[model samples]
Target: MSSEQQSIKPTEKQQILQMFNLLPDVLFWIKDIHSQIEYANTVYLEQVGVKNLEQALGKTDYDFFPPHIAKQFITDDKKVMDGELITDRVELNSDQKGNIAWFLTSKRPIFDEQGNITGSYGITRHLEKNSQVLSDVQAINAPVNFIKENFKSDIKIQQLADVAHLSVSALERRFKKYLMKTPKQFINQTRLEHARRLLVETQLPISEVAYQSGFIEHSYFSKQFRLLFDEQPSEVRNQNQSMNMKV
Candidate 1:
């Protein structure tokens, strides 16, 4: 081989990872046991708002994602590292501009030569570009849209089922099949996401945020918020204020 050709040969791992960059709709990433990013494809980097690998390395999801979203990611990472394989898990992801979207993700634990766990890797496919998956879930669109539009109001599972033109049982089955969450869970998630946005964007009191987000009981809202985000509602507001002051 010529000297230049020999110098440019890609290693097997490099060749494999490089191929992922060619898949425009897929975000590929690897992370350590600590949930620190080790490597990511170009698409993943762009989604996380980082310019390059150097900027992404060693950063946890908390650095790039909203706290609740990052908590979900890290929880999955922990499960994978504990030897569970997560397949085609439907979840929400947000971009740099805070535009949220649904994504289908699968993750597996990476093993060393001796069969010892080293870290984890995963691929996330953007659902918007996946026509097949989207078509399969088209039946649920009506209910999903209704939830988004009416999350600030009292929502019930029966209401969602009615909107989807399905019986409550059938709606529950379809939600579990396609979204991996029950109708009730989806309703709360939508409301919590709205509450989170209001908390960050407005100076309203925490109780007011909860009320405006359709949460009737302030104590219940705080409990669920902490369960999902791994912190109290006040903490999120305090952190946001601290960040603003530093700017």
Candidate 2:
């Protein structure tokens, strides 16, 4: 067995697996080396129309999704088994009624006691609007992608509207209706998420991190960060350092 696998106590494994079941919004599953389902969380079972866990076990994507979608999943499963960690891939899927929905998915390889990859575990986070049209998907992604790419710079709502090919007012309405946030709020959230990661992962001065994350000043950055994460940036960094030292 792989050294890392050997390090995991059976109870620890069970504890982590149980936590997956408790997450109501995320769809989680495990597949065997043969790419057959072995475990599926409650959300996964509900979304895929499986009556029970027993009905889901031993099934593959082909049993729940269209053939084309199944093929894509199978390909990704193989990649995971080959030791790739796939993260945050946006996928289009059909619901039980065959309406298109978008999801952000991730997959990680599961290793045997000897460290050999023996299976996979995955999660999918459903994005907004299960009934979104193909064009709507394109429109939403265009602005979202622009925000991600330009978050370190000053971003204007009108620029986002132009990227999505919608009028300024139309863009605001669509973002609020589908994503439940205004364009500016989404941009701020995105910047804060980046800043949080930087704070935890790097020793950069808070001011520098704030500026890089697109806030005009560290004071504004600290205020917004506290509002979003419920912790001051310094507190998070200190906690991360303490944990690292303990490790």
Candidate 3:
């Protein structure tokens, strides 16, 4: 075995091979943009209507899926190429068996030494167990993650609520119930933390920092900064500079 293969822990290797023995959901692995098969579990053979792994080896997705399915997957594959690591929960009818199914396809790009997108890895799992839990988790985390990442530039409470597909009041209640904080609190906290990171890490001007950190007004930014830190932005910067000089 190669060093990578040799590094697999004994328990992990057993567990991984155990997953392969399952026949309900197929696991596929592809390396490179060509979608060539790297490895497949025993479940893949049953689902793909193939008799053995030998029959499934060395094939591209084009060999498995029809032109339409192949085209759509190819498009989504290029999305990872564009630096999106995504896990899509979708429902579909299998072309092989014409059975309607619901599953999630999760994939992220693997990068080369210089950070070029080299290949991708993904797992597909059936949504048979605990659909409600999955739904609740998505409903709770999706909006928070989005607003946390894109809190800048005129984000209203209503917009974040709308993203959750909940009423303004209902969204507030959900945040309070699940997160123990109001939506506005979450927004402010996210912005404040992000601003602190940028202030300490980057050489950007304070005015630009305010704008980029999701504060529309410099005065409001300063007031909040002092409220949070008990010091002015200049003081924060000068302290950081002195610390760096000492090091």
Candidate 4:
């Protein structure tokens, strides 16, 4: 049994679950190996327009999302069931009202006592269009958007500060306060995220991928990739290739 299943009494488990439901910006859910929704947090119910857990239990993505998006979700779930962990995938999801929002998602397989995969669980954190804890994030939205758009080029901190209409020092302060990263760190993070996607989804040469990811030097790109991922970019490509071959 899992720790929650073993140690927590039913009432206590329910109370802990209620705490998870109160998290405003996160949608959490678990699915069976067949992709049936087993559990969904309160935020998930609100997003899908469900009145209660009963309305969502045993439903699949098809019940909540458009067909195209549902297919993508099932594909990811299948990967998790196959013992692959999917992390930090940025996606645009449409809500019940057809409003689209961006989210950062992650998934991992749930295992049984025998260590066999039983199902999957994951969380998606909303990236936009909600009340932000950092008020300055609203003011810096333009520069953040600009950084995302221009991360593949030679982006400068001064250019970002100018775009945000803040001084260099002021922009650094706000970026750190709102994003928890300095402007340069944010830029590198953006570039690295793009590089990760390209490495997995495309057959581009590593050097070209690095260049397109805004790393002027191949050595520096490799260093940064190792620092963030703890593995060479080549290993990521190799893993993806292996998964593709099996598919």
| lDDT (0 to 1) per candidate | 0.86, 0.80, 0.67, 0.80
Per-prediction TM-score, please?
0.76, 0.52, 0.44, 0.61
CA RMSD of all predictions: 4.4, 15.3, 15.4, 7.9
Evaluate residue 179 in candidate 2 and report its C-alpha lDDT on the 0 to 100 scale.
63
lDDT of 3: 0.67
Candidate 2, 58-162: lDDT as tens digits: 999868875435645776888889877887665545665776567778899998899998889899977663334434556677888898789999999999989
Q: Candidate 3: where is the Cα deviation over 4 Å?
A: 1-138
Off by over 4 Å in 4: 1-26, 30-38, 42-134
Q: Number of backbone collisions per candidate, in order?
A: 0, 5, 0, 0
Write candidate 3's Cα lDDT for 69-156 as tens digits. Answer: 5434655677777787766544333534675444567777768899998777666766544476346545556577677668886678
Name the candidate, 3 or 4, with the larger TM-score value: 4
Q: Pick the candidate with the highest TM-score.
A: 1
C-alpha lDDT of residue 198 in model 4 = 81
- After best superposition, candidate 3 residue 16: deviation in angstroms? 33
- State the lDDT at 164 in candidate 4: 87
Q: Residues 12-120, candidate 4, lDDT per residue (tens digit)?
A: 8678767868788888998999999888899989988899999999999868865435645877898789877877665445654676445678899999899988899
Clashes of 2: 5
Please identify model 2 stretches exceeding 4 Å from their true place: 1-26, 29-136
